[model samples]
Target: MNITSTLVTCVDNWLQNLYTKMYSHHTETYENTVEVHVQETSSPLTKTLVLRILINEEHKQVHIPNIFIPLNFHRQGIGFGLIKEILKVANVYRYELFIVDMTPSFYDRLLNRNAQPAGYDAVRIDTTTRL
Candidate 1:
């Protein structure tokens, strides 16, 4: 998913968890979620950042459960790049449903970063339905 020189890859483990504690104020991990790892070509493993995206094939939807970029990696477009990758996968698999479980601040940031207008408003709670 490297749209540029920076290395963007998928990680199967928490080897970069140390960077989370050192660079973020929140230390909580998003358990049982798939992760997309980002890092510079010259950077070490500990310098990588984790972006979590949960895909539910039964619902044919994609979810952004967590987006955590290290403080040192902020303002470098890493977050946007990560989301771009997610969108690409969704488009390829014909999955248009998206859910962002994030704070207002991060939601605003996401909307400003190439997100389609009113996409969030398309979500419904399904109060009358029971599965």
Candidate 2:
């Protein structure tokens, strides 16, 4: 929860290690990892997230797991905007899209054609009931 941008490269590497361990430990290829992204928060570090992903050539979008923000940080639109910005950037590199199977505002209508629910991926954008 660094209330700032989490380097995608760092996240990718961390996830790789996490996935490998989980697969080997359980004798299965299912697992998740904790992810932290820095954004503007009231304090220093805020909430955190856990993510999981399974790559498929048909899709190209990465999965974002549960995203959360501290109660204080939830007041501002930073969390929502942060998620929007993340999606905007990551969605581009995809030729098709391998987004986690979930519902998002952008995926609601306009971008639905370009994005699809991910079956083996996950991420959540933290938002409080206040927002």
Candidate 3:
């Protein structure tokens, strides 16, 4: 059987406040093409969530445009795992800049929030994770 077959189920209101805070409360419109991938696991055959990334080699940066975990899979480390995977790849490629393009509140919660220590153009947006 396909490992992704076992994944199932995929939000709220203070929940409303929290949601807005986490995702900009749907205030902005986004238009672009993003490469989306699923973070899957074997044995139990589970697909935790989806991640979107856009790499700009000319700018020497990796953009994590979106990271979404279904409601049923939230708080299960799926999101964190996805970020970690991207960061790993970014480091390997030696990308100098990492842009998150995500909510400011959510970016503060990431492990690499402080990865960029210096340089004026080194960081921007809550959408960044230093690799």
Candidate 4:
């Protein structure tokens, strides 16, 4: 018996609620889905923007890859809040996810920054906060 399927379904619904508020102007697709992608460049040299998807742990739930906020933007804390919001909700239901994947440039962007080194991977920055 896995509540994960149900859990993700619920999370997706809640996210859509917020997605509508934040991106109300931009029409969405793939019904009941809100995705986030973390890319490095604004308009990449290539047609595709490689985004890094990081999850802390997972029960193997389904999620759309649509949160496309560049890492540069995340460094400034834009879509980061949304990610945290979703992570907090997921944690509320007790679902843990881990870093899925990212491009080399994604790592390079952070390294290029003059800011103090958080680590080999700043993705370690946790989003799930307790109430």
Each prediction's TM-score versus the true structure = 0.52, 0.37, 0.48, 0.37
Structure candidate 1, residue pairs in collision: none
lDDT of each: 0.46, 0.36, 0.42, 0.38
lDDT of 1 by residue, 1-86 (tens): 32111112322223344334353322222432455554543446554436555556567666666667767657776555555555
Residue-pair clashes, model 2: 19
Model 1 error, position 63 (Å): 0.5
The residue-by-residue lDDT of candidate 4 on 7-106, one tens digit each, is: 3444445345334434222222234333332222344342222222323233433232334543333354544445455555555656543222334565
46: Cα error in model 3, Å: 17
* Best model per lDDT: 1
TM-score of 1: 0.52
Question: Candidate 3 on 1-131: residue-level lDDT in tens?
Answer: 21111111011111232333232222111232233333233323443324445556566555655667656557765555555554555555565434455565655544355544232223332235532
As for lDDT, the candidate ahead, 2 or 4, is 4
Question: In model 1, which runs have C-alpha deviations exceeding 4 angstroms?
Answer: 1-32, 36-49, 97-99, 113-131
lDDT of 2 by residue, 1-131 (tens): 22112324434443343334231211112232224433233443531343333333344434543444444444565544445545544444432213345455533532333333334242332222111
Q: What does candidate 2 score on TM?
A: 0.37
Q: Pick the candidate with the highest TM-score.
A: 1
Against the true structure, what is every candidate's RMSD?
10.7, 12.1, 12.8, 8.6
* lDDT agreement of model 3 with the native: 0.42
